[model samples]
Target: MTNKKQRLASVDALRGFDMFWIIGGEALFAPLLALTGWSLFAFGHEQMQHSQWHGFRFYDLIFPLFIFLSGVTLGIANKSLQGLPLENRWPVYRKAIKRLLILIGLGIVYNHGWGSGIPADLSEIRYASVLARIGFAWFFAAMIVWHFGPRAQYAIAAAILLGYWLLQVGFGPLTPADSVNSWLDQCCLPGITYLNRPYDPEGLLSTLPSIVNALVGVFAGRWLRQKAGQHTNILVGLAAGGLACLLVGLLWHRVYPINKELWTGSFVLITSACSLLLLALFYLLVDRWQWRYFNYFFAVIGCNAILVYLGTSLVNWQYSSNSLFGGIAAALPDAAGTLVIACGVLLLQWLVLRWLYRREIFISP
Candidate 1:
């Protein structure tokens, strides 16, 4: 392979597109629909929010897609590191491990930063979370791509997906009801399950399928790196991958069901498919046509995705809005106050990212 690196605009644009949902779905879009009395749009927004359990939704795609994009980026990163000395690889490995630790720490702190309401004796600080999973999955996937060739990496991904399915079906703990399908939801996962609190959103067993999401993106990255006729190949590969995933996911749903909480195989397949489709669309628009204006907004957030996520978690935007921007929003309606606050949060993060970009500072993990 040539040493030359290709910067894919679509990847950054897709990352920004995914971050848009994470930043603020309700504040950005819901209020407008409420004013128009458009019930369908309102309903769509509601559906975009996560389902309780046992079904897929537009909102559920956000995290998986983010992880998938991370995998794509990892492939690019590995490609850039080609022919480096053994000594250099150690620093990269250390950085990956550090990122994993940071993500896990953040997840724990985010959950219990104020101290859990539950007693310390009974409190089981959840070790798994979306960020934590992403960190682990990205680190491992990157390692595989870096150490092994792309073809072997693809084989490993297949093994994970297929093996996870069989493991869940065969060795998974049986539920009280003795149904094969119920194993994943009731028995396979580790955590305190009761009438009120149930399975951990980020659990141990589900991480298996979650790894596949990242690996699929690794494949996409490999395809993008191919020399001959890159645009047509990427577009075709993305379309086929997305459609195949949608179909396989629907079929798997018959048995496994698309549960985000469990991170079921079907959910992985479907979400990965959606991610591929979205990536293709972004690539076509941004890379092919050079549609660069709208991208800057998302690129700001994309550049500092983890910072924005942590900011939202730590800082109470509601309080900020009430204190800082309250006077201006007061002149407007009730929904207008919420909208202004939403925009303010976005602007706040954007300015911070812009400053960081100017300073040549970037935070990963």
Candidate 2:
């Protein structure tokens, strides 16, 4: 097996790659398109926006991809847990439970507004959030990985995807307001519902399918762990699996429709396919080829991902960026000015993360 520490650098880099787009990479596109008038930047700018109601976009993959990577980490980290006595794993459970609770609480805070002080009415809070979904999905998926064998885990994932499909068909239409997912959110979920009134995209029932997304990551992670050091074999396996998932997802979409908001089974499969392919590319370039120099930029962000994510929401990095680089940005042309601002914001965020990375103070959950 490869050195244990080295195995995770690519994973961190991939995660940073995903988060980069979310924080500011996508914003960079608009300015690029304006400056160069390049169709490529235009295409990227379009992909950056989330699709409305149905269908998919590159932006839609961001949240689920993060959840999926969490699972990948779970699988690799928990491999040794499988050999440990059940009682010996309590510390692990404690740590996971702590992480889950923190993510859920942070998710609520994320929804409620971080800097803008919480609303007076407790009912005003939107309890369901992106972080909460990650917490629930990762925690449950981790439980499964700890308890079940790979074959059983595979069976469980298939059952989850198929079962969620059946539930949607039996309960409600896929429409935003009428779907079972929306209904559950409106009725059972407390606080304010954002995105879709009466339905949060990261709401209740949709979380089920998300678990499968994380499980898919676990599957990929385990595969990578088992085939460590066999670069050719690992590459072929991930590519084949990703392609197979894409095919299955497309075929399923004919019936189910790939809806990210609903967290539909088809959506899970398709996103998981994308996640796998991305992971493969990151693995090949960063891990196999040892491309540390370029990968380090992302790895810094990945190391302190949760900090930067929550920090962006809570702290005003944009204000700081403007303070430091606004004059330089203002001197440039309109499009170039916007690009400079975006780069400044990203650079500020990266600097904080780089500081933590240098001090080895990586934070998560």
Candidate 3:
């Protein structure tokens, strides 16, 4: 395959890897602790869950990672459209807006995508969601790059990070109930939030900084697309960039605090750094080394990422798999056997995507 295609595949593989965690691949280990009665496995299982309010964990990285990937993909897409006349690029913006609407609808559906159906009250709205955040963040980043180009994209990202930090500083200290972020959010929208909490982690105000994560991703995509031919420099630069961002995040945490709920400037730096390094790792394997087969599974899921995400949400995949694979798991003598159920569900998810992959069916945007 061509180098450009390889770069794109790497992005898909990285995305598939991220989706794997969301679609229950991470849950495979949760049952291990009960099966083996081991504290270590128990600790491992706990990591699958999100950190309550402060700090970070593997699960916390999923949304931001995907956000970063969306930005990167947008960057790649933008570059590909460079030769088109300005008038011809209207479709790009049109498609973006349409996708944003679709994603917003999907996010609402995902939250209320239950058997009970949508609630009647507008108060029932869950304004903050994974899909909505991705939509808004990606939309803004793309528009910035489209209108102002890369130079301004970088400037805007930096301004967001700095401005958000300054906002927190100006707000000063805040208790959870009276937290500035949450309070401002509630004041804007009376009854819309995530998990009915005073402050939604995916709230409006916090999404400002999350845009930086995607914009940074635009730069990463640019590097990979523009400099993939220079393998050594890009790889080394990526590593150095990741480390530098991490260092900055750690140091800045002293002031702003690296809170995922807040999507704090520090949190954006730390998560974006991790996303870049992780992408580098995947790109190294799939692009640099040409280890194509290794990423086949990830590529499969990534290709149909949105479709599979919806499948996991809409269907009772876990229940169905337990009916079939629960026996296999039960037959096992060890506690790890319980994981067979989750593995079964994950397998089912992959099979669905695999079928789509075979037919070149990609439900993106």
Candidates in order have lDDT scores of 0.73, 0.86, 0.82
Candidate 3 TM-score, true structure as reference: 0.92
Of models 1 and 3, which has the larger lDDT?
Answer: 3
On residues 216-321, what C-alpha lDDT tens digit does candidate 1 reach at each position? 8887776676632477777898899899989989998898778787677888999999998998888777666667776666676777777777777787766765
Clashes of 3: 1
For model 3, residues 325-365, the per-residue Cα lDDT tens digits are 88787788655566777788888888888888999988776
The better candidate by lDDT, 1 or 2, is: 2
Better of 2 and 3 by lDDT: 2
Prediction 1 global C-alpha lDDT: 0.73
TM-score of each: 0.85, 0.95, 0.92
Across 1-365, the per-residue lDDT of candidate 2 in tens digits comes to 35445668888998899889867888998999999999999999999999987799999999989989989887777554677877899898999999999998998777654333543566666778888988999989999988888898999999999999999989978898789988888889977777548688888889988999899899888878888888888889889999999999999999999998888998999999999999999988888888978689999988878876887678877788889988998898988888888998898888888888999997876
Off by over 4 Å in 2: 80-87, 113-119
Best-performing candidate as measured by lDDT: 2
Candidate 1 clashes between residue pairs 3 or more apart in a chain or in different chains: none
Clashes (N, CA, C under 3 Å) per candidate: 0, 0, 1
Worst 10 residues of 1 by lDDT: 1-10
